[model samples]
Target: MSLSPSTFETIVPSRYITFTFPNHHHHHHHHLRVAVLDSPSAATAAASTAAIWVPPGRESDWIFSTFSGHLQLLLTQPLSRLILIGNSPSSPQPISYNSSLHPSSPTPLQRNLAPLLSALTPKSAFLDDGEIPEVPLLVFEDEVVKSSIVEICEGPCVGEMLIENVELENDGVKEFRRRLRFKRMPNFVQSQMRICPKNVTSFENLDNMKFELDRGVLVQPYLNPMVAGISVISRFLEGRTFRPKALCLGVGGGALLGFLRVQLNFEVVGVEEDEVVLEVAKRYFGLEDDELIHLFAEDGIEYVQNLAKNLSEECRFDAIMVDLDSSDVSVGACAPPTEFVRKSVLLAVRAILHEEGVVVTNTIPSSKLLYERLICEFREVFEELYEIDAGNGENFVLIATKSKVRNALEANEGAFLNKLKSVVSGSYIDSIRKIPRTADPAF
Candidate 1:
């Protein structure tokens, strides 16, 4: 039953559906043309997925296989509309396929796409019309292609690496070993990755990881809010502007570091525990440790402790950003590992910070108790504490300051917006608008 690759025809019966939805300003309409293929084969899926849109550039192959499976399912059942959204709106939408309905039958997709788009499109005036729409298309003839399920990256990757580890529980030590892949899917212009566990055999296990866009673009929504938190520090140092120094504890891909050094005119010190990650960052993510940016391969907590013990005016940082997250899934809180947030560590961090310095950390609290506990722990050391809700509900950026930033949010709101205007470009400014209007719950 062996079949030649050439025996399969790549062409599938594809139906093109064209619809118009009002643009964000409602001044014009955006014509969305989706090609619906009937019963796409593996070759067609791969070709279509690669050609139409990429869910995550690094995991492009896996997404294609998964997409192929769903398309196969469409042969038997009526599935919802498949909407593959790219990170940016201007990025092309992936092709959708529907086989259950006749071409003349007006499916739910045609009926509801407009209303759904209107509701999901962000109301923010600053966001480009290209930003990812926040809604979903209705059910189509067969199969549901989830919206916003994958991370987008700028690509045409040149190199890739697969790091594998095996788990064997022994000697009172257990390793949660799986697969870790480092894909240098670079635009030569930009960078990103695709990682997943070796144990991930099905769609269920694949839930743990996704593709990531590297330093060139802040593909992660939370990163924008994280950058916005720095505006509080910038506003605090206004008029007395000296070259600000920033310390980044967990420099994953060095995206924040690149942003700080190249975009914001700041000297950055990045400390990453994983040497492999550091190398990947340099080789794949465009992280370079030049005069303006210094990279350290060491323990973040110990580094802070050493900085505290050898405290010097020259070593003090204007802003300290802790972006640590635990690899151990069993650990409830994902950011800062429990040790980084300890009172002693916080004190050491404060010791190495300039008087007007600010500390920002990305925290994903697994429980209500942990979240309240973190807020309480931070309030004890810093005179001012604020939270930038990333809107995802689970992720938050905690901004803590040494000096009492009286009404920091209200006082610096305008300044923060103005600062964003100066620092970020149009394509990325949507992140600024992503900042919750009611951010900085505490004054």
Candidate 2:
């Protein structure tokens, strides 16, 4: 069962999980049992299996169950009351509740569950139990894990460092900020990045930037699915040049630009309206200006219109990506804003693309009506449209092409994945494979 991202903030049916434990306040000995319900159907059927008892020694076995796998993630949630099913065949009562539930006082269940909760608490094998300090670690890919708050933009965009083994002195921290580069990262830090635990210097023999890009590493997890355009375009690029051309609408942190340029060897042109974001990208995100990389500080919609008018077919981009967000999200248009999704603007964007080129947009619609409206607008310009739900129930990545070749992409799926594997590590592709993917909505 899937848990909603905002499960704790609101109490909606099938959104929250229920935990059950046998009443232990009495002296009667009984088998320990754990029940977890993640959906409405499961909650309705929980009573039948609520009293299923396990042997005394088998309690540890339940920790490996499907529900246990998500328990660690639960620790980060603002949980409400947990239903405690007593041994008596009566309705359960809330033994304890979170602050959000306006809890009254502790109950007997807290005493019984204390040991089980302690066992479930995550513990580091290398670090001691004593108070560990949070140190500013190095930057991996684009994120500055658990480090001091470094403001990248005036908006909510920022970076912080993750805790690691080595503690840096003030001079070291200053030096890191000066270079804005570090090659070594601890095992735990690597784990936090969801990468294999290894000395980052292992790739010292090769270009470090290429190494990360080849592995398909992106700063934001949602962007991974957004770049599925690479695979879409690969199937039809039989006679095209090995290095494709890409147009990036938003260059926040320059992660997508760097990924496109280094991974696919694309000649990338990045456009960002905010000059401060460009400077921050250069200063903090290691965005370097080179012959293959072009940076423009202008409005994305106007740039697309100008390019459509002046750019030659030979200079057209193979892929156009939109990842910008509106400053005022109260209107519910977050990514690409309302202007970028306009039919006229989208047609202009399509005019400056290769015949086989694809347009991928990152959209975060505030309401169902807005999302449907966005899709209808997209359907007006492109003949074939594919969508990938960012898996967070919030962000969505839409891939649109002028031609009808969805079947071709499916037939070449094996080849496409193989081609990607040749460029990136197999494990990296496997990790991104978990991203929820959906076909066209039949618009």
**What are the models' TM-scores?**
0.51, 0.52
What do the candidate models score in CA lDDT, each in turn? Answer: 0.53, 0.50
lDDT per residue as tens, model 1, 1-443: 43333322233333222233333432354433222333322322322221122232212232222333233323323322233321223323222222222233443334445544333222331136555433334332211222122232322222333322222234644322222232331111122222223434543222343333333345444666677777666566565546789999987667789888876778999997767667767755567989999999888999999989998898999889888765432232256578887999999999999888889888877566777778777877887776676775557788888886554555334543576656543432333222222343321
Candidate 1 TM-score, C-alpha based: 0.51
| Residue-wise C-alpha lDDT for candidate 2, range 1-443, written one tens digit per residue | 64443333222333434444445564664433333322223222221211122222212221112242223222222222122222321212111111222222434553355444322222321146564322111111222211222321242232221222111234334111211111111111111122222345442121121211112465354667667645666667544546678898987667778777777677899998767667766755567789888999888889999988887876588789888776541232256588788888999988998888888888777566777778778888887776766666667777888766545345344553466556543232332221112332421
Cα error, residue 373 of model 2, in Å, equals: 1.3
Worst 10 residues of 2 by lDDT: 182-191
- Residue 209 in model 1: shift from native, Å? 24
The model with the greatest lDDT is 1
Which runs in model 2 stand beyond 4 Å of their true positions? 1-147, 151-216, 413-417, 421-443
Candidate 1 regions exceeding 4 Å error are 1-216, 411-417, 422-443
Best by TM-score: 2
lDDT of 2: 0.50
